[model samples]
Target: MVTNKNKIPALRDRKAALLAFMPAFLMAAASAYVPMEAGLVLPVLGFTIMAVFFGLVVLWWQTETERQTLAMQLAGLEQEERVPTAPLVLRPPVIVGSPLSVLRELAVSASAQEVGAEIVLAPTERVQPARFPEPSLLPSMRRSSAEEVSRMRLVTQAFEADRIELHLQPVVSLPQGKIRFYEALARLRLADETLLSPSEFLPILECSGRASDFDRRVLIRSMAIARHLVARGSEAIVSVNLTAHSIAEPGFLWSLAGLFDTSPDLLGKIVLEMTQHSWRHLDADHRAALATLRERGVPFSLDRAADLRFDPEALADLGVRFMKLPADLLISVAEQSDGRYAGPELDVRDFASALRRQGIRLIAERVEEDEMVPKLCDLGVPLAQGFVFAAPRPIKPEIAGEQTASRPFGLEDAPTLLRRAG
Candidate 1:
């Protein structure tokens, strides 16, 4: 019995208000209705009928307004995406002292307490040299060498009592065509102010049954560094080297999940650099853990590919997308093999071609010669790391940006530009 004029205005006002609540109402309605429908509930049927009728009316009205708003936003977004970006032009490379080299020096010069102070300082002033005083040469010379050694031993013991420390070298990657920074490596610092290379300490840790502790330290520290780098707008990855003992540990997989449960953003950026040393000891549970990591976008890479124990084809099968070859392997293969158009068999070109066919990226490590540069290009190695390229430096925000911007566009510029860009 309502008049048309009165009914129309009331309907319009109700429709607009209903549209404001539509999405949440519709979601709740659908959720309730689905379970009710499955259970065949009479009350659910009545509620769902009312919900559908109301939701449809609100949706029809809202669609018109939303369509217009979305159309305008889409047009703006499309325009932004379509705008051409300028290629990153490079300037002459800057010379920065290596972060790893500095740490090595600090390890030799400072007590563990001083090392902790320096690491705290690293985030703020990474490029600046540590301010620790050099060892007193004249006084030490005047003392019996044994006395100087005893004094140093006492100082180290005192520092170790406090248990403050820094561990792990950050592995950084040169930006390749589609890839950003590859991965990070872990370096351990000891109580005696000695820096232990993974190759040295890792095996001992495994044999001494302390691999799990070492792995935990590496993972936590590497993740902390990765989070710091990401906070600075760099999208570099941190690769942690895991030992067989650590990977094979019960609940290790669940521990990883818990580690990343709060920071899912780190999942894809964490690359597991699994070595032959780790691979040989992996069990079914470990393989399952690796599978889980792969499913979560945490890719794996085979390290030290020159070690004949590693099977490239097997790694490819296990979904490892990258492999690192030692400098000596490239040199040896290039010198020995007979391949197409070879003075020396172009190891980078030949090896890369083979690996590419198998869907793997070949990374040549310790590449330190201008003469070796052309061969790498011809070999089409996607990544090259060495002193000739930039030596391992601290992953500073500005330097990280520069590295990303200078990446080569294709294999055409792979040699000269890759080294220069690095």
Candidate 2:
């Protein structure tokens, strides 16, 4: 049974409690224990104590902040477990780990997590008629799939309605405040302008073979931003995500080339980002398309990779310029029962060094804590992006100029710079 039920730590963490009180502890000790009338000696002691206090302050911040963030996320997950699912007569095959549904579930879980919701762990016996007193499992599964397809089609209506939006998030260079690159994230806007979580929509979109269309729209939007940045002479690279469907599409690269062939410079400035899963299933057509893009100076990257299913060195050999991984998945000290780390159980520091050898810059995403910044730096990760630095915001039209705008200048740019915020 694959359930979203996870090991959620309690809200309070030990180090966080102690770390919050450290400042007061120091102040009290300084006032009560140190003699104030010792003239020069008192000033020296004060200076020494303040120095020590600040040093420990930095230490405590580096340690407890990430722990607190994890604790908070776990609490949120527990709360999500309480959010009721849409009740249906027959459960989907994913509940039973149906081999036929593996690819579908992969797409769903990735989409769910992208929207900050993990697929909750559930029991495996759901599809058995003996367990639930339902009709034959095969027919029930077919019917549930039909309903799932209906849900996907309804969510996908936004595309036909022209309700797609782009949100920009910056990936900053290490220890430098410079915006090295910006990642363009896809957001679906409704007729009422309300946004839907990718988790709620993307699963079935991928299943329905409509993911390529979505990626194409996002690419067009990203090109508009890239054009604007080039006008500003911004050295910052603009990254746009490409889905597995888009990557494997035989004609997608040709379509993309046609879209930007007029301005070859923009293609050079844009970096297409894919996930490990996206690259995992790449066949001859994907390889050819990627090669053609690389030849045209459109670099590719594998970003937000959680799985170690592929060889990073092999990816680098394919002309991938960078690899970005989520911070939690890349660097966790938590040991599993099998003596593995929470993720792939690789020594991140060493794995990073290996990728670097292949000329791939390792980037850490979703980095929210100050502590992680330095640890990432130590691990040889040269780039980091997350809410800790900046959140995704809408690009202003004037910021990019009309010549470079992907869409017509309209009221859509009305609330300039106000993030659509998914």
Candidate 3:
């Protein structure tokens, strides 16, 4: 009745031919032709490297299919994954001091004041389903594309012309009582003293393999500031960030070694932050460099850790002592499936405890509103940083100058205070 519609001729022809010849080929293969004792030999294509890659892809495809099927089976064991299916809205990272940042803060503040803010935020706070990596139509990266070339040139010129600037944002101890450290965020300084976010240039530098230059500049500047802080007797730490791919760069490591040789005490004071995503690009060289630094008492900080891909145990094994999580993510996770988070959830406290056991501390980032402070405190997050504490700004040029009364006897007054007490 259906008239055998939509039949595939190519498939039908292949099946018929295979049915006709496959048995003969199998019979010949099964029948021992020569009297030689050789067991069996299958002719393999000569392009060994391509063959290996094809085999790996085949294996990977099989493994991934099994994993996905198992995941679906597990989902079936649980109740509906997302009841009404709501999207947990996340605030995009805005350029600090931009009008958009201001409006975003106002909106977060308004929503946070609502009594059911936590409930309003969560669809299911238990576990995030793994998201498939987006596939590309181009199959492979085209590094020689015109747009790519233009961007590479732009970032290259910015580095050569010394347009890179480091802006510091304070990370404060909870209760907004004390400043613990300052995070160094890089920017492109415009003629008007405005800044360009990393989106404007970081990818360009990375694609061009010129990220090392920018990384070196930030490290050198951070080292200089570390030295300045030491001479000024400031106990505060300066946190610097770099792509994981650049961790093993010889120049940056050389500069770091020189700084450590002269100022070994500062090694423990400085914190290096890197995103989890960048670590996926790491090679053996960077791994060795991290191990060396870890031996030298330099602990690393983890950033961009609000995803299912983030494995806390793996991070602990990597000698990470600090993690910075977005406040919204933490808030969203704190709320239960039905938005009933009246008390501290067991999973959150257990997670915080586990990390503490591994000597890793959690710092809630983007703490824009006062409303979120109590939530973070309840969750056992010890430190926070956002517009509420301070925005990204250039630290004063005289950072090494006389200490203010509010600060306890920094560099200039330490000796004087000791003398007066004596």
The estimated TM-scores of all candidates read: 0.47, 0.56, 0.54
* Better TM-score candidate (2, 3): 2
For candidate 2, write residues 1-422 as lDDT tens digits. Answer: 11112433322345545655576577657777766676666665676678667756655654565566667889999999999764423324434323356557667756665566643436764453321211112122344565565445445555566566677899988878478999987666643355665555565566667878888767777787887877888888788877655565569876776666777878668888887766765667767777777777777899757654456677876778888888876667322234244456455566677777887877888998888887777766788899889998866634433122133233343332212335
lDDT of 3: 0.62
Clashes of each: 7, 8, 1
Model 3 agreement with the true structure over 69-106: per-residue lDDT tens digits:
56767787675764544344443333332345456776
Candidates in descending lDDT order: 2, 3, 1
Clashing pairs in 2: 3-120, 3-121, 3-122, 4-119, 4-120, 4-121, 5-120, 5-121
lDDT of candidate 1 over 61-90, digit per residue (tens): 555555555577789999999986543332
Where is the poorest 10-residue window by lDDT in model 1? 413-422
- Order candidates by TM-score, high to low: 2, 3, 1
RMSD (Cα, Å) of candidate 3?
A: 28.0
